[model samples]
Target: MDEVEKNKTVEKDMKKLVNKSWFRYWLSAEMSNSYERLQSLSFCYSIIPVLKKLYPNKEEFGEAVKRHLNFFNTEPTWGSPILGIAIAMEEEKAKTKQIPGEAITSLKTGLMGPLAGIGDTIDWGTLKTIIYGIAVTFASSGNILGAFIPLVFTCLTFIIGRYLTNFGYTVGKDSVKSILQQGWIKELIFGTSILGLFMMGALTSNFVKIITPLSFEIAKGQTLVIQEILDSIVPGLLPLCAVFGIYYFLKKGKVNYGVLAIGIVAICLVASFVGVL
Candidate 1:
């Protein structure tokens, strides 16, 4: 092969070398969780193949393995970029002998927290919420296909995670740092937050039900109907108020979800019994 073609072939071969590592990571990202070490064991396990390949010498391989075994935990899917970058760093260290093992450990430790936050916000908070909300609508209408929506989304997540793994390996850490420096990640989080709020508002209006049978006697000849007044002022004011009240308390971070649910049921039962709702 010519020089250019030969270089391309070598690059492709190197990428293939890491595929086994990536696949292992994808399969066991959360399976071997531990309270103390968290995902460190799984993380080390995932990259063991690549580390073995890179550090063929027994002493070097042992040090590389030990470095990855340090406390490491992050969102499995979204945090995948860190794995890709780690692989790149490992490869560099093996080839150049300049990048220290401690640097690799520090890179992982530093990135995990930030990436975990972003992953939790986007994947768990926004994407899953939106998907499940749509699925719930289909489910409530008795569509059996709704049951498979989450499964489909889970598959999609795997595809996304795989793509990110390859992307991180291909692009390396400089690109990731550039993306973060440009504030794109923050904008993504904000946009998703707004979309999540919109979805929640839509769900609340569609599902939450509250009405009152309250009236006030202004005079013997004329009674002031509270429901009519509320309707005139706002069509679904009671439901809105109920949803906002619950949201406020939850945001305060002092309420347990189970307690809130039971309290709501009790309050609704009392209100209905009193003929006020």
Candidate 2:
């Protein structure tokens, strides 16, 4: 085949390999993971279409599949960009046969950590806090808007995932450098982190319920309520203590979440029975 025809065929195959519909499939399936490989299996599955088109031979295709099935785990929403870049790299590798599979794996390994960190901070920490804070306000007032608000806000993540995936494909491997170098992205992350922390504090004070009903007789027909005295010193003090104690326990990593949850329930029940709460 002439160079022109070969180039045309390659372009056509590339177009067929990935599109808007493919991205939707990838986005939906990104979280399909196992305890062992985490997202590695799903990550391979997401790009299977492209890999099939690129590696025509059965042996090459199987190798490609195994190559991608190695260990990988990251936040799905932000990890779309890495998937896109991988697709681009795979395309180049298929056409030129110069890029080793290790290069691709290394790229994924290097990018996953920073991307996951940023993604967790922005998506889980910041966005969730802001959206839930707004939702909780309505929920506390017994308004139904609280339920729908968070659901609507979740759509934004889908949009972001789509955009980042497309952007990664367009920018290719350089996406990592470009994204990390963008001053505005860093600033935005920092700003959102602060806002998220503030929202957490608000939520802690408003929602974490703990109180004391103990009272002591000071004089005839006069009594001092322990809760009232504590409130006079600092409102929500017990709640704050409760929150910090749980945080400390969780941070220690010795206790599993299930155990911690059961402990909290048992403690709460016992405390209520004892009239301490």
Candidate 3:
């Protein structure tokens, strides 16, 4: 009975520790971003409490912290399951001394990239696009509720993150390999990619404004209008081309975003001034 009570107390403390780590991560996941290590410091900061609780020995605690501080970056909300798995593994290591420190490091490095991709697609691309699309519809009609829609989405992210963190804890380390081997994640990525592309296309058509006023005489009392010709061939062709051009430069990874923005504005201004747009 005494051992049972002790186990209960330890379990309670562990839950508290995990919750603290999750809260810290939610608040400051990107706050400590740096070019060199990116989210490493933030990840380390989030799990510090859990590590301290697990490794009471000063040297072990220091080693654990340093182990986590090595080049970690991920999409915080979706990658939160990794945090829970880390905590579970740390607890196992503290108890058994069988799990190598290198194993933990490898787990984080391996999972971060894939989870980041998933998070970016689902959370940033699809979810935000859907939410903001609705918000924009409301805003267009001067509805004050549009402002609160994003707040609701932010809350939903926290809820989803908390649930995923708990899920990782429940699954532990062994199940991750099997889960990754399955088709669900890939299917999810494919579905979300399609939805995101659809949303982006809709947004481009509605918001990206480009038109031409250029015209020339094809014959006596007949004129050829460039914008009309473009419309006849493909509606919103200019805006689509513009979007594709920007996407191309961005994918090349060499263009500075600030410079790109300035160049775009300059082109627009010049086109307007010359009556080509």
Candidate topping TM-score = 3
List ranges where model 1 is wrong by over 4 Å: 1-6, 173-277
Instruction: State candidate 2's TM-score.
Output: 0.56
What are the per-residue Cα lDDT tens digits for candidate 2 across 42-155? 788778888888889999899889988877777777867778788877776686675667667766766665677788998899998999899999999999999899985568
The lDDT for every candidate, in the order shown, is 0.79, 0.75, 0.83
Summing lDDT over every window of 10 consecutive residues in candidate 3, give the lowest-scoring window: 183-192
- The alpha-carbon lDDT assigned to residue 245 of candidate 3 equals 100
Model 1's alpha-carbon lDDT is 0.79
lDDT of 3 by residue, 1-277 (tens): 6999999998889878878888899999999887557898988999999898889999999999999897778899999998998888788778867666766776676677678889999999999899989998998899998888888779878999888887787686455344345634344345545544565586579889999999999899999999999999999999999999999998897997677888899999999999988
lDDT of 2: 0.75
State each candidate's clash count.
0, 0, 0
Worst 10 residues of 1 by lDDT: 183-192
Those runs of model 3 whose alpha carbons end farther than 4 Å from true positions after fitting are 173-277
Q: What is the lDDT of residue 12 in candidate 3?
A: 85
| Candidate 2: segments with Cα more than 4 A from true spot | 1-31, 173-277
| Residue 276, model 2: Cα distance from true site in angstroms | 40
RMSD of each: 12.8, 11.8, 10.7
